[model samples]
Target: MRKFLALLMLLMISMNSTAGLVNAEADDPVLTSEAAVLMDTQSGAILFGKNAEVKMYPASLTKIATAIYAIETASLDEIVDVSEEIEKIDGTRVYLNPGEQVSLRKLIQGMLINSGNDASLAIAIHLDGSMDTYSKNINEFLKTNIGVEDTHFVNPHGLFDENHYTTAKDLGLILNYAMNNPDFREIFGTKQLEWDGESWDTTILSHHRMLKGEIPYEGVTGGKTGFVDQSKQTLATTADNGKLKLTAILLKSEYKRKIYEDTIKLFDYGFAAFKSSQIRKGETFTSGNLKFKASEDLLVTEPVEKGKRIVDKDGILRIQNGKGEIIQAIELKPLIGKKPEAKTETAPEPKQSGLLSVNTILGVVVLVGAAGVWMVNRKQKKSRRFRSR
Candidate 1:
């Protein structure tokens, strides 16, 4: 019977959660990009999405994943022997001469800051023996570490490959994951770097206009740009206000200006409409008799108007907007032990009879015992003094 009730409660929560999202969708900003997603970096909540899940060519956005994957799996200071393969890369190049020795960190800077295809190939080959192995490993890494689905990469750089594709939501997830790492964040946000490569010697600048202040926006932090004939123009951007951090992914914009405009609009909407809240560790939520608690501090995104947290029978926490629209859901673990309040025992009132209450009786006995010890000590001291004289 209890199981049945739990199931019924779960069904109700599911229904309510879906209704909230549908109602909230009416306020989402329309965009010109073929696919777009705005995600809260702190909470991993999708603030707005249009065709977010649809599979599309990621172009150079693939490098964002590559850059992060390399950062986590290997040391940035490790030296890499640039291969002859870089000479064959048709797109952007850092102009690597075969067998040129470069630090892993510099290669990543070139790949992300300058969109260097040659640099990407060098990093990939250095990490894994070949592109085939790199592709397989990166796919697994994205799924296991970042928790992104529907993303696949055939190359380290975002170049046109019919098989190389990812969703806007996945890219947003990747950027959010990457931004958490200090190393990745520093490299991704880099605007310009002096390149003293074997063949190329100049300052390389970030292609993303907003990131470089070419197209100004408040709170812009890190960004990546990708384009090929197949994937018109793709961008990944991260920004933070004092109140909230955000990741925006825009894919397949017909024109470069349109993609930047869409990204700006997305950021403006996310900042204006939503705010971040946290679920503190040990905070408890109840549904009927079932109880759950946050195991650690968990950030949640909500509308500026404020929202309510609803706990389902299964311990799923749903944050709902003022209009009863659901914006984010988090899994809460079952509480492990009895609550502190439950362990407390209330004392019974003292009896009305002449006899002292138990606590008062104990206190009197303790005082008497202390006095007796003091008297004995005094007597012993007097005897010892007399004997010494």
Candidate 2:
């Protein structure tokens, strides 16, 4: 009878304050796409997903990586000599002649804005001297720097290959990381660019209907579109609703409109249901009659819930809500009364080296390349941070 009474008291405490955890039981959105994911760009928390981690062909959406990679590694103003090979490439083209000299930046604009397969070929050849080197260098860039694991690109233009694929969740991570690059964001969000090409003389427009304002969305900041017979349709988009920023991806949609409709629905749900909350490192809390301190800045976007902290005997802290659901968990050291250590200046900690800066992803460190892109080695964990203005 005494034990039952003790359990009841704990239940009462859980109902009253779930250790100050963000709690929201928002309605989950239904999506029609075969695979989709919606995530908080800032908090790195996934708001929703369907087959998020499942591999699927990304089609031309691969250009999102290609465009950003070139922007970071290549000298944009330098001229690249177009090869006759670019002309023979199938699919979209800006129709470069056999021996045309075009700026690297111009080719990027052509590839991204026009979805020019030929232009992508030119870029691959110019940057690394051949398709093989481009493939190796780009894969290295994505793996080492951006921290995307589930994605592997076989082609710069995302032309369908059996091995070219990525998950919607992975795409969200890549987009979020890329958005930190000002140059990449500017190009990704651009609706159109003026094209003065050897064969085509007109303003090249974005294929994304929403980004072009043909299908208006209120907070649409950036987007990429892709299609191939095998991958069907793929899209990556970013939206900000003043309070929260979101990165959403849809891949392998059977219908063209399905991807767009799913994306808009996700934005609507995310904006309406989620809000960002943060808890600083070393902030103390008591739950289950135990004391704990936050390990890092705990950031999340969720429906407001009365939070409570609960700790087990092993010093593991679980931030939960009034309903006893686990929102997030962090390891806490035993709270002991001791004199605070003397302050001393120390070198800043190196940025996290992971495939994704998933704020709560399996205890990974906070990723720190928000203002730019960084290159790191697979065997090396330190960020070689660089910002491109």
Candidate 3:
């Protein structure tokens, strides 16, 4: 009977803790794309999202993940031998003939600049020996490195495979994570390259109109485009306006023009409506009577109008917009000292002493077990921490 009562009290406490977790929702932009997300590159905060979590085809955006994984895993100077499989791969190509030799650095340039499926396949096979192995490696790579949950890439090229799919949120996360790498930023931003391949030898230009100056947009850094019968049109773009760095992912647009329009609208909204806010190192916040402090300087994205910052009892800081809608939540380190609550003195009864002892033992066992499990998991999957430069 005592154990049951104790368990009931724990459930109530857990429910109460989450009661005010969600605040008022802020107004979001209207987009024509089937799915879209606008993220702040510095803080990894989602400024805007429309069906962002919905699983959809990611077309050439898969290459962003592939390029970064390869760049970090293999030496760019290593030469890769092209196999006959390149001929079988369809869609865009750098026109590499079987038995042709190309440097890894050149393959990445061709793959990203020209959206070459053949280049992607060659890099995949060369690194992992087979497409199946490439799929497993990249999936694990994204999950472990980029911390993506809703992405599964069966091919490096993002060709139409029924099993190959990713969400706009995941793609935004991937691109933001990749942009941090200097090598990836260089290749991804290249507007044009003089191609000298086995079969084709000419200048190749970026398919992203914004990056190529065809669709003029200031601060356009890097972009990738993808399309297939099943996936429709997909676009991933990055930009910086001196004050802010932003990443936009749009998926399953019916027309090419619509995606670009959507991307521009997102940038305009992000730059105009949001700004970065910071918590200095050692800054303290209070929730009820508990206190927490920032272990390091922390950056967050919020509306330009200055959102309300609320700290929860668990030491989480939630930044909310003017309408009281949560824009971002950051974890803070709890202070070591917390004064215990004052208790009312009561006369002890001999008859109830045994029951009190049993309840105390039960509670201690449960808490110790829970804490041990949490510690083990925390040690195993420590999340990557980011700080402003």
Candidate 4:
């Protein structure tokens, strides 16, 4: 009875602990914004969201798609001349005069850093022969490959067009894809850009102030900022707090300070609540199934990184195992043929020899017997002749 009571008491304690963790996360204050979302970049898991699917003007954030498309379709060293049509488009400009030539690399920088509408137009014109074609290509790419359904683009630059809009979730997805591309990530994370005697710096002091120690948040790697009367002060940032890396998106906030505050709150909540645990490494996960010839399994001859986490409800509190290690490897053994049949103890018979068969031995015996009979017949004839003499 005492043992049963002790087990029951332990169960109760565990349940209570779990409930407290859940409630602590559920009670976290939601930031005020038209739209917001927090996500884990590696796992692609959404941690928190409010109106995440509502479409709104993206402002300069459209440049992320434009840059991705341009980089893929054109070489960086290729020269592009500014067209008169590109010069006439409205919104931000890198002040590229008509017929001013620049490398595709520089144009990408201009489009991203300066939010240069002109550069966006030039890239579109060069890659697709017209802005309309470029818009169609970007739409196709987003729908077929990037899986961003809530976004639509009528212009390369994120100017306030009735057709230009994306949700916070979709924007996050886009940025996630863009960040995977080295060139796009480097350009977007850059706070300052200079080329061809021209320079553009982020209008917002730090691209990621919460991560910059301006607002007391850690793990701010880099991100992008967006603003327009319609979009307000919008920011998307990625931060790592040792164990967890979080992507936070905020839209239509009152001011830059409010955006940073909201971001910091979300990041702090994530860092305190959850931790990154790598469940499987690419090689480790794939090596288990590798088959040599027709065999089903093979030994894992190579080392692989394995990791995972025991995260709290909010994904903070990285539980350490004394060594600060969260990953380990699993070795796999190879499987040969099927198992032998059960209960048949007798060993298999030895294979037959090809050199001497039963027929060959019998034939040799018959020939020797016939030769002995012939010799005996000769001896009898000789004895009869001697008796006749």
Best by the TM-score measure: 1
In candidate 1, what residue range of length 10 has the lowest lDDT sum? 21-30
- In candidate 4, which residue ranges exceed 4 Å CA deviation? 1-26, 197-216, 281-389
Task: List, residue by residue over 1-389, the lDDT tens digit for candidate 3.
Answer: 99999999999988877764533233466789999999998799888899999999888888998999999899999999987899899989999989899999999999999999999999999999998899999999999999999999999999988899999999998999999999999999999999987679899999999999899999999999999988898999999999889999999999999999999999988988888878899999999999999999988898886578899999999988777778788999988876998889986765767889899999999999999999988866654332221
Candidate 4 C-alpha lDDT tens digits along 1-389: 99999999999999999988765532354686778887765555556677889998877778878888888777999998878897578876777777878899888887776667888888888888876888899998888767988988988878777888988888777776766788876776666654453333334233455544566655677666677787888888887666666778888897888888888888776666455543322222222344212122321111111213233332232322223443222333333346976876888898767665777888999999999999999999999999999
TM-scores of the models, in the given order?
0.79, 0.73, 0.79, 0.64
TM-score of 2: 0.73
Cα lDDT, model 3, residue 287? 98
Candidate with more favorable, higher TM-score: 1 or 2: 1
lDDT of 4 at 14: 100
TM-score of 4: 0.64
| Number of the candidate with higher lDDT, 3 or 4 | 3
Report the lDDT of model 3 for residue 189.
Answer: 96
The lDDT, on a scale of 0 to 1, for candidate 2 is: 0.81
Per-residue lDDT of model 1, residues 212-330, tens digit only? 99999989999999999999999999999989999999999999999999999999888888888877999999999988999999999988765678999999999887678677899
